[model samples]
Target: MVAAVTGLGLGLAALGPGLAPGFVLSYDMVFVPDPAFTRMTFGLTGVVPRHVPSDAFVTALAAVIPADVVQKLVLLAVFVMACTSAASLVPSRRLLPRLATGVCYAWNPFVAERLLLGQWALLLGYAALPWVVAAAPRAHEPGGTRRLARALLPAAIGGFAALTVSALTAVTVALATRGERRPRVVRVVVTAGVLSLPWLVPGLLRPAGVPGDGTAVGLFAARADTPFGTLGSLLALGGVWNGETVPRSYGAPVTATIWLLVVVVALAAYWRWGQERRGAVIAAMVGFVVASLGAVSPGGLEAVIDLWPGFAVLRDGQQYVAPLAVVVAVGLGLAADRAAEARWPGVAAAAMAVPVFLLPTLAWGAAGDLRAVQYPDDWARARHIIDGDPAQGDVLVLPWASYRSYSWNHGRRVLDPLPRYLHRRVIVDDAVTVDGTTVAPEDPRAVRLAPAARTGAPPAVTLRDEGVRYVVVDAEPGTIRPSGAATAVLRGADLVVYRIDGAAEATGDQVPVAPVAAAWAVASLFVFWSFVAPRTTLSIPLLGSIKPRDPHRRRTP
Candidate 1:
């Protein structure tokens, strides 16, 4: 209970006034007022299932409650789940050290950077990682896969990106643990593979898996944030790919030095006095090496991606540092426990406060970078008209790219919300440009339309020929309106919606049914069996036949 409240407090402090009713449309995070579940939501767009189950989950959940509210709940719940879950791993009887672990785990640079970048889905997998790692070793035992499924439910909702990190953690831990390696390794693969089917089935069914420019390897590599350089920043859990996502005033010499010292001390303490550190330490080291690969040797990563596009997952290397964050979180709790053993209560209290003190910018909405803003009323009007239409055709959002710096959204550069907001096949740019160099595009349609967007819109005859039923000009005032053949459907202060006359009806690509359905069926059965099976969260029959006792009990408290 205390851990949950501490998490809520940290969330309230970090998100600050931004938690007020409006949506926080920042970078990759896009939550609409009311999102319609299109064929694309279930991976029918056929390019990649990057959003997959996450988008589907949101659409269904929003059917009962508002999406804006759902977004807020998810963001807050991330902190709560992370805190309670990490606290459960501390193996301490006292509340102080466990609370220390929870706070350190919940309020760190990784969480702050990812939050500011608006990758809340990825953070969901990250929050559940502690349980995933802990429960993995027991997966070979009876009813073990069911429990593992429960641990992975959030990661499954997070789609491809989340599962990538989760798989890395589970596999490395399985390899490192002392036991019959084959069974543990097999369970890890089988369990994670089943939950991953929603995205995996689409990716494999497609001729190519994940498309993008090879240049993304260089663009998304971990970079130096502190004076200690990339290695130092990563060790401190602060080197995310995007600079804007890094918290304000972080990496300053004094702050970086103090934080680095704390990190070294905590890590050393864990090394000196610990059991079960072998698997976590190996996982963290492996994660650090993976995170550093692109930055240190981009050529190797480029070579790998050239061989197979699926390896492009390694491009945004900094996210792989998730296991390192878990290591540091657990290390902090171990250090605090050691301090209390030495009768230095002050040391333990200071350890609890250290994470908060080092990264003050994380509080109060990352110094106002995370403030929420209401969407213009014109957006809702546009959705209404589009939904009213019976014709099936694509909706093209113009200025023809993803990530809008809208005045209405307070100049926050957020992904264009049209794709998820509208009911039709919505086309917006999926290609990402970092520091002004265009990375290769994932969608061929977006690439084809890039030239059209660069100049004015394609001619209305061409638009009709291409099956564009609606072209939405969502530009701000003072932007030039290109002459085009489409009729103006609606003109509001916020946007101008143009209708392409006589456009042919368009149908979305067919997503494969059998494999995806089978995967979903297996995952559902696992979850259902998990519920029907007796709930056994304590130490199970695996891990040396010793029943794991609750960590809350202590010899001296």
Candidate 2:
């Protein structure tokens, strides 16, 4: 029933055409790779484990299906799960109210802008919010142990979804439990902490400073010039930092409509003021305030950014709007239920259609420009050529740029895809420096190659000295031009594999993969298994006997 409702709502919301069937290389979603490249790409992120789950998921899917198809399926699943989760949180059995909640949450402006921005991992985390919220109250219920254990599945899934959401979930759990239930909260926190070690361990073991510059904090901050602009955007769930991506069609009329709906839902919640609804209202308001603080209090946000460890990973504070989005969705459901009870069934029906009518541009892709693009045949051929070489040295990708503006990728700011394509270890210039502040590359070899690649000077001697066997020049015009004196072993339509003379014998400085990375990977598997494993199986024969049980405790049926 949930699937059917989600499919129907998404179809009505015009999500089909917007669903790209090929590579959508905007922003952070540019790390697509073939199945064989997954493990190598996994290590390329250095000791930081944040990209582990996303890389693993894509790699697992790529093993069976084409990577493009896998991406499309994953996106479709995100929409379905988001709608289903929101519907489950509605608490009402009425289909109209539940469907309204689903549509309001899944087809909002936030989802649209993020989809356009290509922040799939972040959106994946947003989709998990409703599930986490639904599971929170269960921690304090009768038979709360079993309930909390059940809740860990979603909590673990949320942790793997995005670090920010994981942290937020932990905070929510801590806040929800008090007095006698504090022990249950501790258990949940400990479980989440253990589950998060894959990414958390790497982040702690090798801490890199924040990615971008000071202006980044301001640019990505949530803006609120006016009450309507601030609260309306939050209510509509559309606090995207990039103004260019937002359509001009989303003008005052749409904003006013969204504001009206929000006002109606707010009044409904106030009128009822049930315990669960009161929590939702508080969470919604708090989320809005935090999200708005990024723009309103940039200085404060900057201080927090400097002080917080994992917090730096979340550049866009507008992502906190996710909690508000979930809250608003639940409110909409409740409002619809109230309207129906008041014998105004048509009002309930109208509320269901409000999101679709107000946020029209979000349908059929934001600004009507999101679609898939196939990679050139040369990319595959070049990968094959590079993989065929039995070399022991790293390959250097020219243009020496971390982000590429490729016409093939619709001029989106995407990370270079070469590192993920080639089987051989690669040395690509990933360091970015702005105003004396620099984010250094993981491999020092990348730093050394940057100067030569920048000057377009023949770096044959340097290549030999650094043990670089081959320089793979992406011969795309207007990018960096390679000038090394070398033998062109293979030349494709758009890429050239140059084998530097006298460098074949030089064993490059190979950075050893950290043993802790392997340990984290193995541990992550066990952690994931514990979440899915049966409770009976987890309680071992000897261990269960050794552990003391509460004699007065009543077993939950």
- The best candidate by TM-score is 1
lDDT of each: 0.81, 0.62
In each prediction, how many residue pairs overlap at the backbone (N, C-alpha, C within less than 3 A)? Answer: 1, 0
The TM-scores of all predictions, comma-separated, are: 0.93, 0.83
Model 1: what TM-score? 0.93
| TM-score of model 2 (CA atoms) | 0.83
Clashes of 1: 1
* Per-residue accuracy of model 2 over 85-163 as CA lDDT, tens digit each: 7888776768888887887788777787777767777777676667666655444343443444444443343334354
RMSD to the hidden true structure, all candidates = 5.1, 4.7
Candidate 1 has which clashing residue pairs, if any?
213-440
Q: Where does model 1 exceed 4 Å of error?
A: 207-209, 477-482, 507-510, 534-557
Which whole-number lDDT from 0 to 100 does residue 305 have in model 1? 87
Stretches of model 2 off by over 4 angstroms after superposition: 7-21, 31-33, 37-40, 44-49, 140-161, 177-179, 207-215, 224-232, 251-274, 277-282, 429-445, 456-458, 490-493, 501-532, 537-557
